[model samples]
Target: MTKDRSVYIRHIYDCIGWIKEYVQEGKEAFLQDRKTQDAVIRNLEVIGQAVKDLGTDSLTASHPETPWPQIAATRNFLAHQYLGVDLTLIWNIVEQHLPKIEQQIIAISNDEGIDLNAPNTPELP
Candidate 1:
């Protein structure tokens, strides 16, 4: 269970790094490229899965700043709603939102004294 605790944090870091890498071409390029869009969506799904795995109690006790419900819901939206997927909002999430969460993850990892950058299954951001 102790190791499981880090799963969500690592997952968040992984998603942030992956999203950053996927959107290197900027939002305009991201919006135009279907493969990039798919990659981003899949990463979001992984992030949401991590959030869901973290659960409410763990999030509140450890990293309460994360909007766990919204993260999980967004994952559901991306995974389930294909036709209604909004590229613009996703762009906003990646460009405007990811950095903030990335910082938050870094802060929490620092406070916990965990080396998130240490090599793991997906490798940390």
Candidate 2:
């Protein structure tokens, strides 16, 4: 893969990792608590940053299965305006959308011959 593609894939993997972490712990419970909403929004911001850094063009052109623009926009909203962040919507996206997107990333990586088990991979932006 080209350097840019490799970077994007790494970003996707990082997002997947974050999602897994959120799910594994009881972090999902935060979605229902208004008090923990800020933390959830913060994590979503990270997810969005990774998506934006991955870029829409290459992702759409190559990995059409992923919704790059929507992901980036979500990230933008979370980062730029925390007050506007909707907890319910964020919760739904985390519970419903992220897992599927994660699977697609893994599939694409395997198809492109990426080694997920490789050591010291660069952090995705």
User: lDDT: which candidate is best?
Assistant: 1
What's the TM-score of each model vs. the native?
A: 0.84, 0.71
Compared with the true structure, all predictions reach lDDT values of 0.80, 0.69
**Cα lDDT of model 1 by residue, 1-125, tens digit:** 23455656777798789889999989889989999999998998888777777675666577777676787788888988888788998899887877877887788788877678766664445
Q: Where's the lowest-lDDT run of ten residues in candidate 1?
A: 1-10
- Give the Cα RMSD of candidate 1: 3.6
Q: Which stretches of model 1 miss by more than 4 angstroms? A: 1-3, 122-125
How many clashes in each structure? 0, 0
Which whole-number lDDT from 0 to 100 does residue 100 have in model 1?
74
The residue-by-residue lDDT of candidate 2 on 84-108, one tens digit each, is 7666677788778888777877887
